[model samples]
Target chain A: MSLKMRLGLVFSGALFLVAVAAWIYQLKEGLILTNMQNSYSWGLYISGLAFFVGNAAGGLVLTSSIYLFGVKKLKPLAKLGALTAFANVTAAMLIVLPDIGKPIRLYNMLLHPNWMSPLVWDVIVLNLYAAAAAIYLYILMLPELTGRLGWLAIRVDDPHAFSERWAKRIAPVALLFAIGIHVVTAWIFSTQGARDWWFSPVMAPDFVSVAIAVGTTVVLLAAALAYGTGEKYQEAYRALGLIIFMATCVHLFLMANDLVIHSWYGNAETHRIMDIAWGDFGPAHLFEVAAPLLGAWLLMRPQILGSLPRLLASSALLIAGVFVHRFLIMPAAYNNIPMTMTPFGLPESHWSLPIASGRFLPGMGTFLDQYAYFPSLVEVAILIGIMAYAVFLVLLAIARLPILARENQ
Target chain B: MKMGMVIDLEKCIGCRSCMVACKQHNAQPPQTWWNRVFTPGSHRHLTPPALGVEFFLPVHCQHCENAPCEKVCPVGATYHAEDGAVLIDYERCIGCRYCMSACPYGVRQFNWEDPEKAHARSEYQEKYHYGYPEDHRHEGRLVYSPLRPKGIVEKCTFCAQYRDKGELPACVRGCPGKARFVGDLDDPDSDVSRLIKSRNAFTLLPEKGTKPTVFYLPPKAKEV
Candidate 1:
């Protein structure tokens, strides 16, 4: 390994260790250590779940679409996409362990699953997606594996042809999974009528669009990192950049559509949610919308896409923006209390329900009608740890696996 | 056999006895109240919402026929009893808190810390634990327990320990204003059913389509 790669592994390994320590502390103390109370029950960790699910789904979608669409120029980068999908899906699954109050009782989710729940569906889809991603990655790498191993001659008479045929068949299936994973994840939030902010039909489509945009960005980063910004890969990079821009446009339109509907309706619940999202969490929301747009704009530039540093930086902006987008999900929905019943047909008579925060500090308000929730230091540590784990896995796979084309070629 | 409650707002003094009775008998740790009462406008009790007339709204688990909480519980932890009461199995709850967001009334409370650690007794009340110091199971599910485990969600069981024993819920029994009534909503002759008929009772957030068993009589101030 290169000196930087060794240093990178050490850094991620250290962050992963810190996450373990924080998780242990969280388990012992209970969820109160996090800022989430009854009102803000879904916090940063849930956001992380959605975010990484988007990443995983997007990465796989990029890999599988290449085979289905026959993007021969993008073929070298397909392995990176599959590898990221595998690693990120694992990270998404691990992140849920810390968010749940009782990890010991996780088996209950499987043993006595409530089919009515969107959460149960998400659990099932996520697991299936992870398994499918692993198999797809292995098959996509089969030709490479068979070439390197003489023992593989017994199993397959023609490994290259077998891989080509199988990867093609699996591509459509993996693409369906990509759509299914994000749709199911978005449904977990949107199915609830309680939080009107999350109760829109548009959310599912928007999630898919965001997934493609973010996933393509992931592939682009992986490609540029694995292969220098040489003329050989320039055409493929241009094609990938176009995918990110178009998908981002779709995502933007969906967001604006939701915003117009909410603001136009102008109900108390709608007004309050918009106000909270824009007012208290304004900067995060700004970044959520701005970063990806800017990233896409930069990718649209012929000059920027030609340079490795500029390409990676653009991808970083997109990732950062989407991270904030996922984090923004909690505040707008949770802050707008769901109790909108009018008493005696008088809207003013409807009182704000101050939810018990499931926390008590001597001087603070114990019951909160609205809360501006921020993740505690412990939660932040764990979130970073999870990101590091994903990074470590991606770097390790790239280093160990036959991810890039053979150097002699 | 649909168990429910009806709170008469006109008779309610907003004394918050129901809140206290619920907290004590339910063995709620600090920062948890299965039932709470507040005026419409102010944090203070008895502050009128409009027309300078005082009335209190006591909100808790609605025991809805179409409970969002029950629908969203991934593990079948929150389920409806045969008697139409929404109950949670503490042992079954995975502490995901999805049900907390799904409930419109915001009555669900999670044990953020170990209940024993949070419910630290003061010197004046040495070694004395509050609530019906016994575990209460309904239909083979551990629905009500004094020492609840941390991380799981808990809410008003309508005092299941007392209800299962053929007694009124503590809130209904302890209300000084006699404002709270509990009985079978399914029975035409029951107090809750009659009150709904005679008082033009309504449930909170009816538009949510939850079909809550609990009802409330509009405050007389509206008529005035």
Candidate 2:
């Protein structure tokens, strides 16, 4: 293994252990360890779920599209893309274990599943996405694996031809599942009319766009770093960059379209809610917009695309940007109850719900009109652990498997 | 029977008796209120809004006929009881808090920690673990317990335990001003129905279209 990969594994392994410890402590103490109260019930953990799901969806979708469309340029990176997707979807599922109040009682979600809840659909899609990505990845690696472990294999005259044929059939299924996973995730928020921000038609399609942008970013970054960004892979890099940029622009347009309507609603309650994203949360929202655009711009620049370090940084920025977008989903939705919408003639000051903050603050007031949530130290620790583990897995897979041998050195 | 509540905003003195009584009988944990009295548009509970008159708007589970909480609970933990009340089965809940988010009224509260830890803070509570000291089950669902299990959702069951015994809810009985009433909302001749009809009754956030069973009589230039 490379020094960077070894260092990453060690670092992530250490953090993942710490995350396990923190999660155990959290389970022992119940959700009291979390900053989430009844007021802001869903927090950083849910954001992580959304962000990682988008990453997972984006990766596999890119891989499958290569087969479906027969995009020769992206063919080489298909294995790595599938690997990334498999790892992320797994991480996405694991992270949700900590977010729930009774992690042990998760079986209840399966045994007594309510078909009406979008969350149940999310549970199914996420699991299905993980399983399919794994199978899809094995197919991508079949030729290489058969060569290395010849004794165990039924020899195909052309292993490459056989695997490619299988990959073609799985491509459409994987692509549709990727889209399904994202739509289900978005519906987990959107189906509920209680949250004004989430109850929109655009959330699902917008999530798909975001998945495409961030997913391709991961593939681009991984391909550039793993195989080395050389003249041989120039066309692939260009195509991937265009995909990321176009998808990101589409995401931004939809977001802006939603924001414009909110701005024009011409009501005090809406203006106040809009002020949350436009005012107090402006810096975070600003970063959400600027990072992806800058990163996409860097990749689009052919000179910067060749610079491996620049490619890595752009990918990091784009990933960070979408993560922020996932997080921004909660604030406007959770910070205020939509019930505060006053009658047509009532004055503008229909206040935010004064909700009980579950944990005792010693001397501080327990009730808040509008609570600003920051993840507790334990929550942050667990989040870091999950992300690091996903990174470690992706790196380990690429290095260990002879998977990328067909591509450039 | 479509059981529901009708609270007259004018008659409530902001005494918090109903809030206190509900807490006592229902055994809510620290900082968890199934029934909360608020002065609407005020920064603090019971504080007057810009309207200058300090009237109370006590809120709880509306027990909507088209309940969002019931629909959103992934485990079918939250359900509409036979009496038209939205209820949670503590044993069945996965504590996902989806129902908490789905409720527009914001009445749902999760057990952040053990109920005993909540009781430890107050000397009075430490000595006396109040509420009806029994597990009340309806049709095999553990709807009410003296202390709910940690890591699950709980909310107003409209005093299901007391109602089963043919008694008024703790909140309704404890209202010193007699401002609260409960009856079969489905029955046209019921007291709650007549009160709702006569008093310009409204449910909170009618625009939400949850079709709340609980009604509120908006104060119409009345001095209590």
RMSD to the true structure for each prediction, in A, is: 2.1, 2.1
lDDT of candidates 1 onward, in order = 0.84, 0.83
Q: Give chain B TM-scores in order.
A: 0.93, 0.93
Collision pairs in model 1: none
Model 1 bad stretches (over 4 Å) = A146-154, A341-350, B120-128, B222-224
The digit string of per-residue lDDT tens for model 2 on B1-224 reads 89889998878888999999998898887788888887666666666654445667788899999999988888899998888988899888888888888888888898988888766753343466778899999778999988788899898898998888898999999999999999998899999999999888988888888999989888755333
| C-alpha TM-scores of all predictions | 0.96, 0.96
DockQ, structure candidate 2: 0.64
Name the lDDT value of residue B16 in candidate 1. 90
TM-score of candidate 2 on Cα atoms, chains taken together: 0.96
Q: Candidate 2 falls in which docking quality class?
A: medium
